[model samples]
Target: MDKRDLVIRPIRAEDIGAVQDFLFTQLQELFAQDGQAAITDDVWGLGKTYLEPDNCNMWAVFTPEGTVVGTAAICAYNGRIELLKGRYHLPTTAEVGRCYIDAKLRRQGIGSKLVEAMTQFCKDHGYRTMYLHTHHFLPGGFNFWQKQGFAITIDQGGSLEIVHMEKIL
Candidate 1:
């Protein structure tokens, strides 16, 4: 497909179903390979977690046919991490996640576009920091965030080896 044909924009109510399906499939594939995965509440409740929150938003990359091929989003921190509670105000921090591109469409800059859109959203919404966690098992996941200016704040080494990353916006 032509890279020029892909469009990235904030998702609307009508796009929720497609976006959720895309996310679930991607997570399932990753889990099948690594034997670890949890589809977050945000994935199941995109409308409430993303669409309903004033400071949260999700963007999807759509094909010319309007299929959701990529997604990225940010939501209020809401005390997900005790480590961040003392250092940053919960409301002013955004937790970034659901950043995935269709495997066939990877490395074509779609992920960067989604991240760019979310960063812009954070700036417009007055967020001071952005946080995200990616499992080391995901190929290039950590390196990708590093390229986007996120630095490792914590690396929980265990079965999943969750790497928590953050970027100051």
Candidate 2:
């Protein structure tokens, strides 16, 4: 649990597989609960996309032995900003998602460390606000974002209810 025992850095090409497996495993569990397929949008495995996109970045938290324990992303999703801008008067927003931490490692501060790194990355990249979309299905989704200073802005229920949250940053 010591800070020095972990490293947080931009994900590399080789990291895509392990990170993808980690994320897909989580998604699979959710899908199984609904008796659905585990497959998700193909973008989850695209490490190069995260690297080459403008104002987009992702990090993987690794143990001293180099096992990836957590991940976070800050991406340029301007299209989603209109929803917040029209309603909340929020400024330019960077979208943050694709964050996951190995369940066994939860409560050890790895998630916070990833978020801190992404926050610095966003600030350095000139983002003064952030937006994230999470559904109630995601474990600890609401509370975690709230603890990170994000407030729930919208939640719409249909076949699925997506929660939208924002932070002034």
Clashes of each: 0, 0
Worst 10 residues of 1 by lDDT: 80-89
RMSD of candidate 1 to the true fold? Answer: 1.4
lDDT of 1 by residue, 18-40 (tens): 99899999888876765676767
Model 2, CA-based lDDT: 0.74
Give me the runs in candidate 1 sitting further than 4 Å from their true place.
83-85
Q: lDDT of model 1 at residue 44? A: 81
Candidate 1 TM-score, true structure as reference: 0.94
Backbone clash pairs for candidate 1 read: none
What value of lDDT does candidate 1 attain over all alpha carbons?
0.87
Output the TM-score of candidate 2. Answer: 0.82
**Each prediction's whole-model lDDT (CA):** 0.87, 0.74
> In TM-score terms, which candidate is top?
1
